[model samples]
Target chain A: MTHQRWFTPWLLVAPAAVWLAVFSLWPSLNTVVLAFTNAKPLGGGRFTGVENFARITDDAQLGDALLNSVIYMVVCVPLLTLLPLLLAVLVQRKLPGISFFRTAFYTPVIASAVVVALIWGWVLEERGLVNGLAQQLGVLSGPLPFLTDRWLLLLSAISLTVWKGLGYYMIIYLSALGNVSRELHEAAFVDGAGPVRRFFNVTVPGVRNTMALVSVLISVSALRVFSELYVLSDGTGGPGGQDMSVVMLIQMYSRGFTGHLGYASALSLLLFAVTIGPMLLLLRLNRKAA
Target chain B: MRKGWLIPVAAAAAVLLLSGCGLGGDGGAGEDVDASGEVKGKVTFQTWALQPKFTDYVQGVIDAFEAAYPGTEVEWLDQPGDGYSDKVLSQAAGGSLPDVVNLPPDFVLPLVQQGMLLDIEGADDKLNADYVTGGIDAYRYTGHNGVYAYPWYLNTDVNYWNTELLAKYGLDPAKLPTTVDELIAQARTMKKESGGEVYLMSRKPELGDLANAGVPIMAEDGKSFVFNTPEAAAVLDKYRAAFAEGLMPRDVLTDKYAGNAELFNSGTVAWTTGGGNYITSLATDNPTLAPKVIPSPAMGTPPLYAQGLSVASGSKNLPTAMALARWVTNAENQAAFAHLVNIFPSTKASANDPFFAQSDGTPSGDAKVIAFTSLAQARMLQPVEVTGAMSDIVKQQISLAISGDASSQEALDAAVEQCDKLIGQ
Candidate 1:
């Protein structure tokens, strides 16, 4: 009876295990194998050891893409993680018409990236809202090159990423906030701790695991962001492709025009490794905190 | 949740994912049929922008083809102009290529390299009877030894300038520069006289700058880069200076295919390069600015191309596909197709016809005459002899130079080195 009971648990997990193996694990393994080959767009390719890696090193735009990706992650991760926590705490209170504000904040999460880009593209154009405001205030004479300048374009992309991610992470934090014990806050109140201090000591510590989850999620999204950048800048990546993300460069290589499937696969593996490195660091930090 | 309770959710998740199977593959290669034997089976014909507007005309052509070739069925498909090149190549690789499909000029070399196109030499004599030579040359990406597509329609280069903007600064539109230096001088004068309020250009005249300056972009072999000299550097420097001077739009380096159209129509740019049809679009956007527009001769080798039709080499119904391709591009059909879309036809007979050559007194007519005149010198920018992979590297390097991030000499040297590596590879 005991042996049968143990066997049933394995049988129960077998389906999910097979599902992951076929859909996720196999494709990732295939991609890693392809990084070492002269793969065409389709299936077959010839093995060419380390040639793709050499090409990656020699690629002129690789450095720019990596730097852009790093800048993106740095600007976005903290913004998504903290801003949403603040917003979630604010909206979690029992207030009249609070759901409306919650819905409004969450609207962008459901909107497509292309749609968000189009709306923001208009708002940031020369004659658009920001410039109009500047012109009205007489603080600036000419329109700001919001979408034109390279640094400004990167700023715009990072801002867009933060805005799009705010509501998503807010929902995550809201669920975690529900699990935060009210007794801790009551006990802190009895101890004479102020709202800010109690929040730092109680709410933040209570949601430490959720913070780590949000960090990983936002980091991956920031690293893989392409569509918004592409739609906002029309895919040129701002002048000498200074604002181009690593994934966007990989996309260009994978497109039928460039036909660098092997190189793109190598880029994919590199991106995977890059994504995992930060994730591992986040996990380590999470463990230390625990 | 309990272990037994979680089983339902996991099973459901696994089932949902496993059910999402990918079912995609081609029907198979077509069987051989006698040239004169009764033509049968279906051929899927496609185009980029020839539907809804030309529904009747296209249907008539299909009906005629079907009637002429008994038992043969023509299935027409229309794809959007955006991203058609990528979609076509991916489809070719997926083995689900349309029997006869439109070929974008940029996709021609890539598709040929992938061996997805049919060698249309089987009926070359009939197909080439009175076709435009440049159009035919554009489709022959594999060189004179092979023909991959049937030339269909052209979009000749014509630069439309804002005469109102020019005349406001006491500049004469009739005295437009024919050479690169003169153009740069004109740009400087426009920027200076206008006090930097109005820009002179929005796009970098790549082909024009090189073609007019008499600098060869690539050697005759197309494999070697011969543009690393001072002449190339001068052209790059001139454009870089223009950009630095704020003569061009800020998006000059990154404007996509719909380059600077919105900026020009908004009365910002003084010059915009496009085909004759843009006159209508510009006029539609700004009614008052329509009469102020001046159509000028193309300055460089207008690297416009005739979108053509190609039968996939892996097509099962080659005979039917070839017949449909020929029928679609025959002189009479091409002229009719041109009338529907306001595009330049690629057949000698159609282009030579008075409908395209003769000018009416309207602004649109003047634009057409300039476009037709420029067609005589239009060159396909995709150099046939050069590999597509190498060309991309060259173009990206040129963009870097234009952005002023890389010096002109550095860009050229880098292009040369990369091209050599690509050749060696």
Candidate 2:
């Protein structure tokens, strides 16, 4: 057996360990401490002891934000999970110009969210392409308030999130599909299973673990949605701030004279608590599978 | 002995964690300085996003200041426009604020409250007489006892109308609205004539509009808001009624509402309020639309906007910092700056400058002439205490009222209550 100095392991991990301590552990601990205070962004703070968390109960804006999160998650998880898997299956085959199609679908995933949101903002404006085309088709008498109405704005952000996320999840599904048993697929085909039957019985069960992981990722991302909603609404949080996400509330209180860093920290803790539910659920499901 | 390294690692971790929390430090406090000493030290001067465009002008001013002071040096730092408030706040908290800093009226309020800025009036008694009353009064907060900054530059809003759009919609471009009631009547006429294809108004009523209509936005002491009066509600009611009648675009209350300048550029709106340099800037964006633009005085008490240079209270070189601030804001330097841009000079003596009084027969030149004259009657319409967050609450409440979700009075009351709560906090 080789003998090494006692500090060798420590020296190797010191860089990563220090980074984690400074950026992650320290900030998380400080956030916990700050959540009990009334800290302004300019740095004067005193312990108010649950006052911020107490305000969360009566905050009508928080209530609206929670509802928006639920709607976003409920819609995103299923669409993102199944649509990406189907897209992976379609593109997994060897075909002519397949790389081009794959790249075309994956382009939005690589595009900057701000640029994408700005383009969508122009596309959904009252005089934009969508409304103009619809009106020109004699399908409507007037333009629809796609970017103005609260529900429409929320739905628009959700659509953008899903559109942008599709290629990312598709690549994950493609990697998982490669690991599935090709023999099982061929055996099911020989047994006279149709494409739909084979996909459900063979392909799905094979990638069930990857699907759970994707669902968890989608759930956390939907709960933590910021840029899609922020850029879409130009950072106003939609009409009367009714379509705000919890993360948006945190960002709202993180700067400027009106910013309360302590309250933002409390909101951050609440977000961590909310997101942990999906993660715990995934862990439970994995344990059952084990 | 096997885990000897753990002790040092744990110690370092604890130190990092404790330092990150910033235990026992009151970041808001700063030591007051006496400015009665000789001015011969290096002073750091910071401006907001004025580089590359005004580089030569600012460098020239700095060079002149150095020449006048002989041994003094001015280190210039120009910050970008985005996230400037947050940047300044962080710098103040970290005790790294520049010696001489340029800040607007609203941005000065927080620093003054924290005692981070020097009292300019206390430092120099005769300095107040150099600047215009409106310019000096902007730096005087309601609760603050002394002025905190030397007023630098002044600008006010000018109404820009698209003559071609108005003429196309059968509204006379020569006869522009001079008051809110007249503006609303023209909006109605334009709405009917254009079949709602175009809009005269493209924005919701802000605090300035309510103040222009004679609503006191705050109480005398400035501790709380009192703009929920019937007069304010009446102004909102007019907007609500006009909105219901499709006189203004539906999206104007929402985030989808780009400002009036954008809507004007697109030819969807006939009016936008901008600074004296509006026509010059507009020509760069859309040259075709610039020639057809008409400049007129704002519909109400033209809202005054001022930028000023403040001295950091904790600055070691207080004398040089204060001297540099005063020298930069002097009438000669201000007039030189005004000559480069259409912005007005804050110094009272600059009012006599012929450059501001005469028009070069261009649209922008006419705008400068009108803005210069309007500055005489202009005041800071929106109080500095109304923060961005408070403005957002007002925006949301007013949006609720305009969309028929609540009455105008209820909206104003809610806005006042929320804004007052923020102030109390």
Which residue pairs clash in candidate 1?
A: B30-B316, B208-B300
lDDT of 1 by residue, B27-69 (tens): 2222232333346888898888666767899899999999988
Lowest summed-lDDT stretch of 10 residues in model 2 chain A? Answer: A38-47
What pairs collide in candidate 2? none
Q: What TM-score does each model's chain B reach against the true chain B?
A: 0.84, 0.93
For candidate 2, give the DockQ: 0.53
Question: Per-residue alpha-carbon lDDT of model 2 for A1-290, expressed as tens digits?
Answer: 99998788989998998899768888898898878776666545666788888877867778889999999999999999999999999999989999998998899999999999999998998889999999999997898887788899999999999999999999999999999999999999999999999999999998999999899999999999999899888888877777789998888766686576777889999999999999898888779879
TM-score, every prediction: 0.86, 0.94
Expressed as tens digits, the lDDT of each residue in B18-106 for candidate 2 is: 44544444455334457989999799999999989999999999999999999999999999999888788888878899999999999
